[model samples]
Every structure is written in C-alpha cells, then in structure tokens.
Target: MGSEGAAADRLLSWDRVSLVIGLLLLIVGHYQGLFVAPAEAMMGDVGRILYVHVPTAWACMLVYTACFVFAGLALWSGKGKWDAAMEASAEVGVLYNALLLIQGSLWARPTWGVFWTWDPRLTTSAIVLVLFVGVLVLRRVITEPERRLNLGSIAAVLAYAGVPIVYFSVKWWRTLHQPFSSPATVSDSFITPLRLAAFGMIFLGIGLIGLRWRALRREVERELSAPALPAALPTLELGQRGPGGAA
Candidate 1:
C-alpha cells in the first residue's frame, strides 16, 4: 500500500506538471498567433482563430482515438482501469469536440457569411460529437459496473467508426470547408505557432485524461472492495403468523 500510494502520487504529480506546461505553451502560442504572426493573406486577422481551432481539432481526434484503443482493451481484458481510461478519454474528447464546433462556427460566420452550414466536414464532425455523447449517455443509464463497462466500451468503439469519416469527408467530397492543412499548404509564418498550439493541446489533453482516469479507477476500486448487502428476509402477510406461531 505504501509503494502503491507513492506511485499514485508520482503519477498525479506528472499529470499536474504536464498540465502546467501545456497551459504555458498555449498562452505563448496564442500570444504569438494573435500579435507576432502575420495576418493571413486571404482572411486577414480573423484567420488567427485557426491557431487554436486547428489544434483543438487535432487533439479531439487523438483523444477519441485513445478512447477507441482503451475501449478495445477494456473489452478484451475485462479490466476496470481500461474502462476508466476509455471513459476519461471520451469525456475529454467530447469537450474538445464541442470547442472545435464552436470555434469552427466562429470562423465560419466571418468567412462564409453564416454561422453554420451542412458542409460535409461540419456535418461529419457534428455526427462524431453526437455519437460520443451517446456513449456517455449510455454509460450513465446503466448501473451494473461490468455491464456498463461492456456496453460503454462497445458504444465507444462504434462511435469511433465515424471519426475517420469526419477526417476524410473534406477530401472525399467537394465541400466549402478547406482540405487538411500541412506544412506545405500553410504559410511558413503560421507554422510555428500552429505547431506550438497543437502540441500544447495534445499535452493538456493527456494530462486531463490521466487525472480523470485516476479518479475513475479509484472509484471502481472502491465499488469493487465494498461489502455486499445481506439478502432481505422474507416478509409475512398481515393475517399470517410467523414461522413458529400457532395457527
């Protein structure tokens, strides 16, 4: 127990350190993006949103991918920790997905003259959000831990099937949304801050998921360790006597 506690402490310390570093990087990157980086040739200053937006999209995809992997592990191993990890990643992914949609809408309004549209990228992204949200909802509705883990893992796996579609939608179909950005495609001036913010988001997501996973694992352990309630005694009818009573 002593060694286990020490290890847990070390893990939590690492998570905190990662979160702090991620936050610092994000602040620096966003500052550079907003002030130091050159305005885009086409969208002008508004294009700065991509610094955070693009990073968020990347982080969301990676987090969901982690959830998928964890879900598979939970299903195969029947382990509580794996299930906890899956839940944690799913939660973080949902948050990132929500931010992605909001940022996309903000970017869209000025560039496309509307807050939203049924563009293939946007549609698939929204579907991804809905599917993961359903996974969370399914987990909440189920009470039995083993059953919940099995079903939630299954749901997460199914939800992840849409992620690839979301990623490839812009390429597979002609849409208003732009294709995937790369170093070759984006300007040299924009790459530094974009990369910084992307790495920042990834680190932050890892920290958040790790912390959440620890909490969930502890909860599962407690549930498993707790003593089960004794079975209820049989009840007697109003007019009936006790087992030893005379009629």
Candidate 2:
C-alpha cells in the first residue's frame, strides 16, 4: 500500500484503540460508581448520577471550547482543515451537551422534584444547546462552501461565549444548581470513578471527533476534486436555423 493508505491505517488503528480504552474505562467507572462508591451522606443514592453527569457536562463544555478555538483558527488562517475540526468538534459538543441536559434532568427529577427549572445555570445551559443547534441548522441551509465555513465559524465563536456563563452561573446567582466543589470535598472512594469517567468521556469524545474530522475531510476532498457540472448545452433559439441550417 502507498503512504496515504498506511497513514489511513494508522489513524483508523488509533481510533479503534482509543474507542476500546474509552469503553473499558466507562464500564469500570460506571460499575464502581453504581456499586463500589459509597453514597453521598446528604443526597444518598440519587447523587450517584454525579459520576456520569459531571463528566459529561465537563466533556460537553470542553468540546465546545475546543470547537471555538478551531473556529477562531479557521477564521484567522482560512484553513479548511480548521473548519473541519470546528465542524466535527461542534457536532460532538452538541451531542454531549444534549446528554448533559438529559442526565441533569434525570438526576433533578428525584433530587429537586422537578425536571425543568428557570434557574440561571439551567437557563444558560439551555441557551448553549439552542445556540449550537442553531449553528447546525444554519450549516444546512447555506449552500456556498466558503460562505458556510465563514458563517459557521462565527456562529461557533458566539455560542462559546455562553460556556463560561454556564460554568459560573451557579456561583453568580441563587439557583437550584449546586456549585462545583474541589477534589478535597469528594471522598476517596468516589474520586476513582469520577476521575475515570471524566477521562473516559474525554478520550471517547476526542476519538469520536477525530473520526468525524477525518470523514469530513474526505468529504471536502471529494467535493473539491469532483468535476464540476458541465455547462448546460446552449439552447437553440426557437424558429432559428439549427447547426446544419435545418429549421
């Protein structure tokens, strides 16, 4: 095989390895979180959702931040690769963000007795979701390549402005959401699973993003290399002589 094929094989190998490691971590982490880790003194078993929820929320924001950086690079350098990275990261960010909201709601229903609330943290998170959703929708409607890239990058940057707000909203306002605490606050037993889940989700998210970026890059390459549609054959004027001078 050629160098390109070898490179593709290497990337695919890494993607598979990363996915396997991430899956294993998730399995071990979830098992520990559910069975081994001691329940919270105040929240009891309901708090177990923290293992998944916290990590997912972290991954969601992390990907969005990366997406924003990619967008900035794309806008500055006008590089299609950066745009591909931005698109892939945006997609992963949206997926994790949606999951974050779902996991929060699931935990909330039992803890707060409500599935939805108008709290600041929750509201900002919803905005984060809607903003990215709008970006994806905007991407679909724009047909021009350069225009789409420029506009989508701008949208990603704007959407990222909400991320820090989401993180700090709990602290900045009186809300139903709990403020994030340091590692010292968590028990040793709980720490293992939380850390495992956090790293696992990060690896999984990055791996998935890599795979998506590769796929998009291929699509862009195909689009660029594909032959343009042949110009429509000039229509013969009605009532005019044909090419052979036959009407």
Candidate 3:
C-alpha cells in the first residue's frame, strides 16, 4: 500500500462517519418532529406535514448541489471516476426530488382541496426531476466513456441552474404554497426539534452522498481496471495522453 492508498482509506473512513452520524440524526429528528411536536391551530394534523415536506426538500436540493459539485470536478479534471460520483449522486438526488413531489402533493390535497396544482415550487420541482432524468438517460446512450462524461457534466450544470429557482419560486413569485420556514420562520414554542430535523436532513444527505460516492468510485475504478471481455465489451478505449492519467 502506498500514500495514495492510505489517502483513499482515510476518505473511506470519513464517509462511514458521515453516514452513521447522518442516519442517527435523521431518526432522532423524525421522531421528535412527527410525534413530539404539538399540533398546529390552523392546519391541524396536516401541519405535521411540515416535518416530512421540509426535510425531503432540503435533502433534494442538498443532493443536487453535491451532484453538481462532483460533475464540475469530473469536467474540470477530465476524470471518469468523478463522472461516476456525479451520476451516483444525481440518481439519489432525483429520488429525493420525486419523494418531495409526492409528499408535497399529498399535503396539498388536504390543505388546497386538490391533489395537484401549478404552483411555482411544484412546477419547478417537476422540471428538476425531468431534467436529471434526462441526464441519466443520456448517460446510457453514449457508449464512449469520455463522451458520456462530458455530456453528463453539461446536463448536471444545466439542471442544477434550476435549483435556486425552485427553492425561491415561492418567495420570488407570490404563490399558494407557504414560504419555507425553518428555525428562522418562527419564534414561539416551535424551535427545538424542527430545527434539529432541518439540520438532521442536511447531515443525512451528506452521509448518503458520501456512501454512494465511494461505492460508485470503486465501480468506475473496476470498469477501468477490468480485463477486456472476450467479445461482449465495446471497444470504447480511453487512453492517457500528455501526462500519466489525469492530473
């Protein structure tokens, strides 16, 4: 084992720590938010939807941002390993976004009297999902590793550009959906576990991303190192040029 191997091991350790801490906080916060928080005056039982909606939304954005970060790294350094990380994070991010849409719609039906509406937040969120789904699909169509990476990077940046719009659409444009309110939203009798839940989701997203990233990194490494198949593997040969591998 060399210094590079030692460094990879340390990163692996960091990922494990993040995953454990994140799951612990998520469970603890979910319990408090769902069971312990007092019912609201206006929304009644439906108000408890806050715990689910807010956290999932937070995680969705967090994961997308991470995916974008990894995408940028892949494009900047021209490394297939970072491309795998980007793809992995985007898969999980899209899942979180889908959950956000479903949960938001469920909450909407009770409060708004309809299962679906064209609120800016909801509409933008739907667009976000479709955009990244395109990214995943595009990844499959390209057989060449380098071309796939470049296409994926472009998709990531374009899709991520919509994230801020989705998050702030409610704020920027007057909308039926309530503006987001976390610790900063209230000051009376409602600041404890809800705040914890928000932070909990943050950590949880971080941990999940780390775990997926490391796993995907290994997968890309294997693909790079694997012996050529007898006949099935496509001859999309990637080569090192100008220097040893990528800088």
Best by lDDT: 1
Off by over 4 Å in 1: 10-12, 166-174, 224-247
| 75-169: candidate 1 lDDT, tens digit per residue | 99988889999999999999998999999899999999999867666667788999999999999999888899899999999879767766576
Q: Which parts of model 2 have CA positions greater than 4 angstroms off?
A: 1-5, 9-12, 165-173, 224-247
lDDT of 2: 0.81
User: Model 2: which ten-residue window has the lowest total lDDT?
Assistant: 238-247
lDDT of each: 0.86, 0.81, 0.77
What is the TM-score (0 to 1) of candidate 2? Answer: 0.83
Q: What does candidate 3 score on TM? A: 0.79
Tell me which of candidates 1 and 3 scores higher on TM-score. Answer: 1
Per-model TM-score on C-alpha atoms: 0.86, 0.83, 0.79
Clashing pairs in 1: none
RMSD of each: 5.5, 5.5, 8.5
For model 3, the superposed segments whose C-alpha errors exceed 4 Å read 1-12, 164-174, 222-247
Model 3: per-residue Cα lDDT over 38-96, one tens digit each: 87778987887787777788778878888999899989987767888898889888888
Ranking by lDDT: 1, 2, 3
lDDT of 2 by residue, 5-25 (tens): 478667456666777778888
